[model samples]
Target: MSKIAFIFPGQGAQYVGMGKEIAMEHKSAQDIFEKANESLGFDIKKMCFEGPEEELVKTEYTQPAILTTSIAILSVIQQNGIEADITAGLSLGEYSALVYAGALKFEDAVKLVNKRGKYMQEAVPLGKGNMAAIIGLDRKEVDSIIKEAQDVGTVEGANYNCPGQIVISGEINAVEKACELAKEKGAKKAVLLPVSAPFHCSLLKPAGERLSEKMESLNIGSLQRKVISNVTGDYIANEKDIKDLLIKQVSKSVLWQDSIELMLDGGYDTFIEIGPGKTLTAFTKKTARKLKKKVKCYNVENTKTLNKLLTELG
Candidate 1:
């Protein structure tokens, strides 16, 4: 028997007009957007649909907006009787995965992510921190370089995206040092990412601390579908663990590559990325190719993609 996994995309996946088509076509999708707006006490819909891209990209607005849009598209998928055996997400996308798994209420998730984004942004001063992508480097080799660069300043592995692609984050000096060293260490390319803050590094510990305090005030429930955690690359089964993981995730490397491997180990052969952009899909293809496994991956961001996925899956 084949199992399907529903994956959600993170920050870089957001665009000006993401889920507008789904919202206009499906009442379920529209309801998600409406409820998110009411819960967030702002018009996130407008920000997503009519974004002055710069304003929409603010951490506070971007986090909740992307979560809501992903869930809106997810609601449409679920309404059409498409469901997943397991779910996972990247960075901010993890909250969307939790919402789909029934581990969190959509209203609470929107509010929490809004706060999460703010805390994350405020954790480090602008331009003080940086993140970079090191392509064509093995994970172990990149980890070694990150450790070696620590002498210059704080540096840590951020996202283990795929077999040959890893993202590192830390102080600007440290990140630059790592980039220079990475190229010398046989990496094809090591370039700074266009991000305001160094996410998923020790530098973001302050953000994690603030998120922990805020998480205590929310009401989280047990999940119906299995949800993979970014911090552990393992299944989060309880509410307490879920809360702890979300807090830890702020400053810990996202073990996305490991998480996908674990999903495959659990017998999932098909992955459906149900959100905006094809970021996760691109990574999935890379991972599958590296593993020499023929996996089915689909990306459903609009009605056309959704219909095609439904037909293919059927």
Candidate 2:
């Protein structure tokens, strides 16, 4: 049996000219950008195709932009009759997974993530919050190290990205201290990440509260496909749990590695990174390696990638 999982990339994966070629080739993909523009009341298509980099990188813009481009690329994949048996995504990328699952409509997702991004940025001041990547270290050790440095501020593991890669986020001093401590603790590398806010940590609880209010107004539908939640890294239980999980995801660690592991354990043998960047592809491959599971990985950000996927999967 060949089960496929479609995973999406999160922030730091966005770049100018992401979905243009896909949009130009597929009318369905083009319609997605047009609809996003109508729902958002701005030309997100232009921003994805022609970005100044400065404006596109803003937290508020980046969330919606990536979600839109993902759905656009998803539209093309659907038209080509390729589908996933399961799906998951990283932090901001979770919204894309929900959309693909039919748990959230594309239009509503774009709007929601737009406000979600703004709330996240406003939750912590620029210099006050920080995030860093601790490579070649285990989460338990990272957690212990972060707990040791809590007095410095409010740092915690934000993203359990892969086997040996964990992202910690919180107050600036705490995060910086944790990084130094990680270096001392024999971590292969401990480096700070360039991000606007300390997302997915307790510091962003206020942001989650804000997102809850916005989520209430939207009409979320039942899942049409299995979707893994970032907070739990497992199958989303039911429709009622969607909004709460999404809200909690704002201030919770993303169990991305766990999510991929669950999929592989459940028999998903193929993975396609459907949005921008091959970051998730790398994560999935690394995770599969650690799990001693065999899997095929692919990413579709442009026509060439799409053609390769279609030729094989179609």
lDDT of 2 by residue, 4-70 (tens): 8999989889999999999998899999999999999988889999997998999899999999999
lDDT of candidate 1 vs native?
Answer: 0.91
Off by over 4 Å in 1: none
Q: Against the correct fold, how does model 1 do in TM-score? A: 0.98
Task: Provide the overall lDDT of each model, using Cα atoms, as 2-decimal numbers.
Answer: 0.91, 0.92
lDDT of 1 by residue, 1-314 (tens): 66899999998788888899889999999999999999989999999988989988999999999999899999878877888979999999999999998889999999999999999999999989999999998988998999899999999999999899999999999999999999999999999999989999989999999998988877888789999999999998677788889999999999999989888777788999988898888888888787777788999899899899879875
| Per-residue lDDT value at 306 in model 2 | 95
Q: What TM-score would you give candidate 2 relative to the actual structure?
A: 0.99
Off by over 4 Å in 2: none
